[model samples]
Target: MSEWMVTQGSTARRRARPLSPLREYLRDTFWFAPMAAMVSVFVVWVGAQALDTAIVEALRDEGDYDTLDELLRFAEDAKAVVSAVGSAMMTFIGVVFSISLVAVQMASGQFTPRVVRIFVRSRITKATFAVFLATFVLTLLVLASFDSVDDPRAVTTVPLVQSALTLCMVALSLLLFVLYVNTTLRLMRISHVIARIATESFRVAASMPVSTGGQDDAARLGSATAWVPHEGRAGVLRDVHIARLVRVARRHGVVLRLIPRIGDFVVPGMPVLAVHGGPVPPRRALRYAVSVGVERTYHQDLGFGLRQLSDIALRALSSAINDPTTAVQALDRVVQFLAALSRRPLDAALHRDRGGAVRLVQPVPGWTELVDLGFTEVRMCAIGSPQVCRRMLAGLDDLLLLVPPERRQPLLRHRELLRQAVDRSEPAPADRAFALHPDRQGIG
Candidate 1:
């Protein structure tokens, strides 16, 4: 029997737990019910006073009980109606209060005070002004009602000072409302204007080209040339085209350091890498330096294409110098081809000349050959930063240009290797690569 009783008790406890929501709702309604009752009391009081006044006035004027009795009966009926309305309102207020209490309880631990403060501050000013205006209007209506009262003793005349005070309150309320609306609209307009100006300024800044220093005269150029140290610790070049320049620098036995790693910013007139081993020809070094500066600026302006072009040109130039057969004619032919391509009308077909004449030479085959030779890489990197890898790719492209068509596949394989190297070295964000975790549950 004791074990049976224990099992029953457990069942009862579970049943009780399910009713907690209803119980919580009922508890919350208790506090707000009284407020509704008070409002109902106020309504009844006003109605009863107005009806009693009408009945007394009618009785005194007509000297009859019929109308007075009828009015009294009507007032009683009205009272009953009002009482029913009041009771319904009380129930509704209770329900609302209960729901609010439950909501507050649910949020108690999680609610941030700072967020609450922000909400309160935003609404308090507007709510206070509304209350003040309502009070002022009510006061004016009450003063106007005094003039309509039948009894002379009950209808007291408002003093001039009191009348002025009432008028002042009404005026103040109107003024405050106008001020609030004006200030809010002005602030919103100013904020929108400022935001637009800031957005335009940022767009302009991002589009502007990076600047570089220029030598004013031959004498200044000569002075700038002296700034390049004859002997110093070699520093690695940070630019993407540095690899190509390294090869050129290597031939001259200058200790050329190709700056490895990424995100290093180089300023104008700053040495990207320190040259060492021996005194290199200042004129040749200056030319390389100036070319590099120009390439960097171009990359900043035109993006990766022009940088690659410059790199390829420099590499081709370097290779031609080394080889006996191709040294003289390689640069001239390439330059002539480039000039012709640039001058051709945008709509002109490759197969025909501008005057509908048969072309003297096919441009596509030559262009393809140059591309196959690795000249494309130099061309792309020429307009970019003169980092070692870029310069090296440019050299490879130049070397490819000299290679026979049959050997193009091997050159392409080498270019792929260089591209892989560059990809591996470049810095990238981790979040962009792969996600480690997945969300397990749905969120509202």
Candidate 2:
């Protein structure tokens, strides 16, 4: 067994380290959007310049009077073409931006507000923005070369080929805009949203290794320990640097116990980590390894995805919305996610160093806790809603059939709880019986 003790005066207060600069820079959709557009602009400019130079050289070699005149005439058309493209692309950018903002607003109001981050981070939206912006820049660059033709002192040059390239870019942007519209429409649908979240949550679950019940053959933490107090402002603890913590603990030959699980919040003076043998490592190094952010992320916090759908279900169940069907759809996703989680072991995790020594002990939510997190609140909020309650019962049955028998006990208990809730809150005996029967389409 692990012995634990914290000295009263041993708590060290240190500010949580800020996120790495490079990571912070890359995570923002705004940064990547402009950077991609700028790179595209540069590449298109270089290609256009090369093609224009080759055309000038070819024209000089031929020195054909008729061809020169035709080339000059084409330059006039190229200028008009590029100018139109530039104006049109600028307008398109504004229109698409407005549409994206409206879509985001609707999604936030309909679903959970956190999902707005998903829309902004969408690759389709970013790619569309990049292509349109790049087209605008290419047009401007082509227009700049028009002066080369007008100048008598310089060798006669025309951007006939580059203008054709700009025209091609215009066509590509239009195609992307069509796809963007399709993606936006899909985002608006409730079924699509629920499915997307379930798929992502399943992916996150698949990435973890099967648990050995978190048992460790190595020694556990002794009574003597140093408590590492939380520093800085409070926020969700999104990730832990278990590997690094293990390495540091092994180097000092001590066990480090992290108090909060991923997705937990830590405020000032909370014991974030307990060091059980050596003095605590430098505050900055330890803090750098732990990530605390404004909101929960899917990187390692699997519960965040479920929370997103749960919010949508709760919103739909609101008095103003009163959309039971939408809540039922959300419950379908909840069942899928919980079924996936049921296959894996969820217990306190123990990470060891290369030397086979237990260096890090971090707490994790067990299956019962996760089941409660995923279902309790929504079921409670959905008490009188027959469609929602029946859907929940059906989901519980499906999950009971899907997962292994060892996991079936909890599902069985939860199913009983749902029945009891329906019995108490639902006044109609016939309605309660229908909900208790577990039909996918609910009482209807």
The most accurate candidate by lDDT is 2
TM-score of each: 0.21, 0.85
Clashes of each: 38, 0
Residues 189-238, candidate 1: write the lDDT tens digits: 32332222223222222222111111121112121211243122233221
lDDT per model vs. reference:
0.33, 0.75
> Predicted candidate 1: what Cα RMSD to the true structure?
30.8
Off by over 4 Å in 2: 1-21, 148-155, 215-224, 284-287, 401-413
lDDT score for residue 416 of model 2: 84
